[model samples]
Target: MKRIAVLGSGTAGLHLSYALVNSGAFQVTVYTDRTPEEVKRGRVSSTQVHFGPARAREAAYGMPLWEAGPELESIHVTVGGQKLFTGGLVHPAKSVDQRAYFFRCMKDLEAKGVSFVYGRVDEERLQELARAYDLIVDCSGKRGPIAPFPQIGELSPVTTPQRKCSAGYFHGVVPLEPAGVSITILPGAGELFEIPALTALGPVTILFIESVPGGPLDVFGGIKDPESFRDRMRAVVDRHFPAVAARVDGEHFGLCDERGFVQIAVQPAVHRPYCTVGGTLVLGCGDSVVLNDPITGQGCNTASYCAEQLVRTLTEEPVGPWDERTGEAYWKRIRDYVTEVTQWSNAMMGPLPDHAVGRLMAAAADPAAADRIAGWFADPATAYEDLFRSAAGTKEQAERQGGL
Candidate 1:
């Protein structure tokens, strides 16, 4: 059997393993730092998923929504307390407990006959594993083993100091509306994303805020424990976002990590087809290739999208020299689309254009424009020709909108 080693059993690794196993010709062994049981139980990132990407990635693995749900029905964009706009599955948002979803994905893959190994993958370890497998795939999201390659200016573009994000899980009262999820953009200070998700505590909501470099959270003021964080979150919402704060009742628990904001970013996105030592071929995906800022919640989608392209590349592309020359075909397939998403995400971290924000508000006021924007979020490539390379507003839609 052609052994394929997948480093990091997180979302990307597991998803790629499942997809590879389904082909029935390759053997997949998942390597990770934590034991399967420990990982399945520990605190993981809190995630709010939209139906379009979630469903697309799942189908890529031949899995069903039963692991997560029937699929969230819709998503609404709002600010403060007032509803700005409402839209349905032109793209939908489904809230999911990250741990539950990750483990479920792991379980489903195991049942399909894929293998997993637990250990940290370092430079030495990766090279050792490379000798044993016919191919190696790095699905290490975020903290995964990295392959040193030439740092392309835009290909791996990133600003120093990653963005900080603090998120919490709360229970008690349900949200006022029932679209499955609500995303409120605060623009300057931060943005709060509230979504109804499935969790051990039954159904609940997640309130998360993303603070840029110099934002208020820099002092680590509001958001320590459930109570203090609640007070702090309340203060912000009360002053800037009364509508969302009003829905705050009962108890709210910090997801994990008392740290004010989580910091992460990477060279926009880069993939080296046959990353190797000597001449062996190694592939990478997810945060390893590009750890996108979590602001837009596109992390999982980025990983899965890479896996999708990898599977097809391995199947059709002549498994070339497992060297730089051979790996080009794999990353090239989806680079344009992935690049657009990554660049757009990076741009979002910067200051929001006043006129653009005004236009967003206007769009929110007009459901049609909001719906179009929602669809853009769900899948920018579908609506825009070059989302990664060009600036955010330079799309065909923007030209039609008359530069807002």
Candidate 2:
């Protein structure tokens, strides 16, 4: 049997390792920096809502089921203080704290007989891994690909971070009706996403702020203490997002734990997912290859999607040396979907186009339109089409006018 080495244990690495081991076609080993216990006890890593399609992929790979978090049925939208429509999802989504999710999955995968080597994989170790395994899949997440995968310049257009992200899981916040994710957009200032989530401390609401740099909502810098973070978040809500503030039970409101919050900013970039390291063909998956801003909440979903595609590409190819051709084939299968997701995600970080704004206004008057908008989070292809379709039409119209 062929041997494969998977790097990192985040959504991408764990998912790919599970699928590979289940297939019984390859001997798979995972290298990660953190152990399961450490992950569970660590600070919150990200705010995740695994929508319908991503959850389905996990289920197919026999990943562990999470029954704790609220079943997100709809997406409640509010723009500039006006309550918009609630868009229902075709399939329910759930947000479990990555601290809980990743830790559990790592332990579960270990129990399933996947070898786990715990340590940071540096350049020297990576070269050693290249010589040992037949294939090395880099699922190393935001911090790296570790291998030298060339960045695709055209796709990596955004060189700077678009939003200052501050997120925390807290108690005493009321959940919205219909049990869903709540999105509050403050136009130029940024957005607030209130998500009902399950953590090791039980159910909590994740208040995520995507603030434009130096904007009113970009207030979470330098406060390292949990109490300070919690107080600042509360103040920001009361001052800016009154809708969400109204649901805050101030007497009991505070972070679920001292380590339940994180502040981060992502500079979006995309890289060609294949390369050669020490004469061995290496591949990249997840954020290591397709990083994007969290404004659209597509990171985990994108990682899951790419992991499944990589598995399909590997299994379909004839048994032989996995080379540049294999990487090209894998990239070909996922490029279109990745483009759609990346474009939509990047667009979200900027001002909403006129057509997109119109769609939101129309959704307030039409439930069907609202539902379609909600589905965009689950499937970004639809969002991409909606945003670009108008632009394409406008270009054609200009061409016609010029000819006339």
Candidate 3:
């Protein structure tokens, strides 16, 4: 049997481990810093609203018990004070807090006899593991740049972040009418995504504020407590989003737990995703390879997509050397989708084009147009081909901005 070492226990790592374990073609072990208990009680990771395709991948891997809330059927996009459109999705999406999702996945994988090693892996340890396994896959996410997977310079044109994000899960906000993601795009400032989510505390609203640095929404820099964070978020909503602000009950609004809120800035990035260490080629997956700005809600979904692709490539290949040729082939399997997602995600962070806004206007007038637009959330590759690609004049405009 081929031996594999999977590092990190995030979405990609866990899903890949589950698939390999179920295949019985490889002996797989996972390395992660946190135990299932630790993960359940840890600080919040980012909000994940997994769409239909991602959920299908989970079910295929036989690890499909991830609990989720209402079907997020529409996307309500508001520009400034005007409601641009309330778009509908063909495949329903669901939001699950990462802490709950990871913990459940880890426990399920453990019951299936996958080995779990608890500790952080530095360069020396990674080199050691390289010699012990036929393949090593890193899904370490923000806690890693674990391998020397060089940044794909063309794909990663920006070295600094475009937004400072202040996001949290809370219980006091009123839910949207159709129960979907409420996207408020504040042009020249940033965007706000309000999602109805299933969390450890049951269904709650996730408010993710993507703020342009030094702009009106960049207000959560030094926030510490739940009350303070709530106050600041409420104030921002009051000033910039009157409709949403009116929904917040000032006295009751707060984070779901002490660990529910987070403040951070994410600089979008991409890497070549494979590198040699101790004569063994190590592969990268998920955020470690193609980290994007969270404006489009593609991170977890992309991770799921990549994990399934890698599993397909490995399962189809003849048993042989896990070398450069094998690595290149696997990269080819996921390269196009990865590029499409990176392109569309990066384009979203910049100013919205006139034509893109025009589509939103048209969608507001017609549900058929709205549903077509919403399909992009279910399958982002379509966004590159039609939505972002044609609507925004993305190909030429992206070139001007030095995008890949």
Number of the predicted model whose lDDT against the real structure is largest: 2
Query: Model 3: per-residue lDDT, tens digit, 1-404?
Result: 88899999998898789878878888889999999999999888888888999888788889857674778989888888888777788778898888878888888888888889999998999999988988899999865779988888878989899999899898889988898999998889999899999887887899999999999899898888888987888788889999898898777788889899888888888987788889887888898888998888898898888888888778888877877777888899999999999988888888866776777788888988787778778888887877555854756787888954
Error of 3 at 372 (Å): 1.4
Model 1, 133-212: lDDT tens digits are: 77787777766545554444665566464566666665643475545566776656667676666675466666666666
Runs of candidate 3 with Cα error greater than 4 angstroms are 388-404
What lDDT score belongs to each candidate, Candidate 1 first? 0.64, 0.92, 0.86
Q: Which residue pairs clash in candidate 3? A: none
lDDT of 1 at 253: 36
TM-score of model 2 relative to the true fold? 0.97
Candidate 1 residue pairs in clash (backbone atoms < 3 Å): 32-119, 81-243, 156-267, 165-261, 165-262, 273-327, 340-388
Clashing pairs in 2: none
For candidate 2, give the lDDT of residue 321: 79
Sliding window of 10 residues with minimal summed lDDT for model 3: 386-395
What are the models' TM-scores? 0.84, 0.97, 0.95
Q: What is the C-alpha RMSD of each candidate to the true structure, in Å?
A: 4.3, 1.3, 3.7
Question: lDDT of candidate 2 vs native?
Answer: 0.92
Indicate which candidate wins on TM-score: 2
List candidate 2 segments past 4 Å from native: 394-404
Q: Is candidate 1 or candidate 2 better by lDDT?
A: 2
